[model samples]
Target chain A: MGKVINGLDIESLSSLLDEARKNKELVQKISKWYARVRWAGTGFTFNSYVRNHSFTISEPSELGGPDKGPNAVEYVISALGACYLTGFILNATKRGVNIKNLEIALEGEIDNILVFLGISNEGHPGYRKVIAKAYVEADCDEKTLKEIWEETVRTSPVGNTLARNVEIVPQLSLIK
Target chain B: MATVVNGIKLEDFNALHEELKRNAEFVSKIHKWNARIRWAGSGFNFTSYVRNHKFTISEPSDIGGADSGPSAHELILTALGACYSTGFIYNATKRNIQIKNFEVAIEGEIDDILVFFGLSDKGHPGYKKIVVKAYVEADADEKTIKEIWEAAVKGSPVGNTLQRGVEIVPQVSLVRK
Candidate 1:
């Protein structure tokens, strides 16, 4: 099996690597991201971009926002869940596993938004703890799928980043 | 100058903080978040919910996505910018300074997408470094505004979180349903 498995094709990926190696311009590639927030009537929304993709993030009416979209903290969790899921789909398929369905639920404990604004410095400003439950289903047995899961989490850029003393946040589950 | 500025009442905010302080039940605020992805015929799409707010997250046309929405990295940056900006408005207004125009440009450098998907374990998966530039035009002197900006970053939830570092890989479970 090449680098491409399931929906992920590793051949093209390798080709890119080959091109980079052949060119010798630089072996490492860095991704750039940009996010902009404009003033809204009562609140604001971010019109952000990454590699040409764009979207808006906002707060709900409860937070004095238009409730047009989700907040930054929420997006943090979204990034965690989404990043893991995407990695799994691409990687698992490469290993000859087909996912029937999958779901990952994430929960976290934060100090306080008030603390974040320096309103009160009593507690930590970031998340103190996080937990995730993953349910997975695939062509392989639970053990084998879990082996892949371990790899998924182990290899996940987001997962690994968060694991370095950030907080005790869990990330994974395959649909059974 | 009182804390109330830009129509946001600081007294109200103070009251909430005091209440939480007085009542331990309000302590250790636990925020719940959910994000689900479904195949959109050609690619995957996500609808994430938090604080009763919803939004779409997708890839651009380059990655075979419908280019329907922003990627996850973009959202993270958005959160940082918005949070910092909010802090600026609150602090500036509370100090009795009127803001003319404000802008915050945030940039981050990630190792590579291949590192993220585990194609190669040769690089760091998340952002190696992030740079932020804030442009502030206010009634007060530049020095004062800069001081306020410093306070904003110091007090910013997103800024602090990113700087302090946090967990990324959430624990997983196998859903039988």
Candidate 2:
């Protein structure tokens, strides 16, 4: 219903990162809570969302995931879309960009082989590069809207993750 | 490229947990369903392991798609749902406030109109909305369940993002070609 914005008041999200930093206890608890909840490696990060109840998503269909779950790229796009949307609302709340309806369309282009092989020495395999395209309709002028959009992406946590290449530092050393 | 770091805390995690607990509808529906998704970009993952005639998802009666591979949205929803579910379950179990079954359901509408029209835009103008419904089946009765469901939607990561609007940022850098 309402969002609190301060341009760089990401303290709220930082707390989540804190949880990841202190994930030793939580990881074990999480795995025990649900056997399906498995921790693949260290450096735990949280990217949460709701599950789709409609179609059965399995392997080898379209998104390049096996018959088990969604491919990471699609998830990336979702995260981008969701993060962009969150930034939009937060910034709008902060800047008081009234107006009305807003919609976003996001997609990424990826290579097929890299993803399937699970050997992205660079990053994502299938889609070597993915692009997210969003359209906005608001009460402000095109120039204003464009500026706001740029700011949103600049601040988006997920967008920042994709826009920049990140090196993971493992806090916990696994037995393997 | 600009970089931003996010850190979650017990308080934040608990807040998200409470949100999902309140939104019982989304919680229950998602668990019952399964998706067969494929990574179309480059390679295959675990889902492929099973679909390629290798393993099993659940029991033999375990529900699965005859044809493997998931649509784009299906995969998105699964990730979102899984995150929510995992987070919810983790927090809820820690709180010891659970009873029975829980599920999360996400429904999305995407538009390829720009692609169809060959128009250039940062994002798609066609994708209208994606609706998320959470369902909960618990021994706590209906009223408590309702409260929990409400909390979940209000605080859950995915729900909050869906409820909030998305912002777009476009940047250009000069590179020798």
- Best lDDT among the predictions, by candidate number: 1
What fraction of the native alpha-carbon contacts across the interface, defined at 8 angstroms, is recovered by model 2? 0.01
Report the error of model 1 at residue A73, Å. 0.9
Residue-by-residue lDDT tens digits, candidate 2, B112-148: 2122112223444222344444445444555555544
Q: Looking at candidate 1, what is the lDDT of residue B60?
A: 49
- Residue B132 of model 1, lDDT score: 67
True contacts kept of each: 0.41, 0.01
lDDT digits (tens) for residues B1-177 of candidate 1:
655445556676456546655665545342444454432322345555554555666654444345567766666666777767777766775576766666666776665555654455686666666666666655677667777777777776666666565654455555565
Winning candidate number (TM-score): 1
Name the runs in model 1 displaced over 4 angstroms. A1-30, A41-54, A61-64, A164-176, B1-4, B7-23, B30-44, B61-66, B167-169
- Cα lDDT tens digits, model 1, A17-41, are 4564444333343366666664342
| Candidate 2 segments whose C-alpha is farther than 4 A from its true place | A1-69, A112-115, A118-126, A169-176, B1-177
The per-candidate TM-score of the B chain, in the order shown, comes to: 0.81, 0.45
